[model samples]
Target: MGNSKKVILLGNFGVGKTSLVRQYVFRKFSDDYMTTIGVRIDKKMVAVNGQEVSMIIWDVAGESTHQKIPNSYKLGAHGIIYVIDVLRPSTYLSIEKEISSLEDLLPNVPIVKVANKIDLLTEKERIEIVNNLPLNDYVLCSAKNGSNVEDAFNKLAESLI
Candidate 1:
């Protein structure tokens, strides 16, 4: 394994990508809607499966028109956490398109499908969405409550390592 792993947080605007990162790393939450102007970087040392791992988490800007993330960002990423809002069906629908684009840019890199805001969905609705996906790798998470957030990161780390 590399000395450090690069992971990118990807999703559409207003889908809680930043909120998920903030909650995971800082354990805080807010209801504000601020567009991420550029890539925000955070680092943490994690112990995954008994080995120490350093994570260089790139919280990529959500704005589609913002060109802050250069093409090079996709080159070195070991894994990607593709987040989609469970409360917003359109965001869920767009996951495939986003994944396609990512694969085109970085084929063969592992991707962890994250259904964020799971706390807002009922069991039936959650099941419906899960049943319809490609089902390679996925996690149901709630950044607001810290549910399954660590598991999502751990799963990605496990794959990368």
Candidate 2:
């Protein structure tokens, strides 16, 4: 065991924040859409630079605007996993605004932008979506099929160290 870091998942409703946390921490995914009322916490150990780092994940309930999230939930976070659904442009249309709000709350916190539910899209579609997204760097993941899920968390863990 090694030092632990606090990480948070933030995004709009139904963008798969809970699903990503479930997959990363438990290696399981479900189609059921259980709305998170407040926040769900989970822990996972990841090896980064040959050192074990415990990742404390706070899966906060999604809000239309990041500003609406409870300030208490945003504090003490070492990293942020900002997720969006590839099928919903509306979810990410205000990406700059959302990210800006996060930055305001947690300045200098490392953020891993993620596009979840990639399993629902074709390979070409995935590439196109990534290209069109405003983010220069992000992970394309599928909680349902377990693609790039580990890599995403590993990247965040690495940054924490």
Best by TM-score: 2
Candidate 1 lDDT, tens digit per residue, 1-161?
Answer: 56589999887678788888888788888878788776889976788778888888998876442233577766789889888776766666656666778888888898988888877878998788677755456788998888999889888888877
Question: What is the C-alpha lDDT profile of model 2 across 1-161, one tens digit per residue?
Answer: 34889999999999999999899889999999999999989999888889888899999999887788888888988999999999899888998888887888789999999988999988898789878987768898999988999999888998999
Per-model lDDT: 0.79, 0.89
Worst 10 residues of 1 by lDDT: 62-71
TM-score, one value per model: 0.85, 0.94
Best by lDDT: 2
Whole-model alpha-carbon lDDT for candidate 1: 0.79
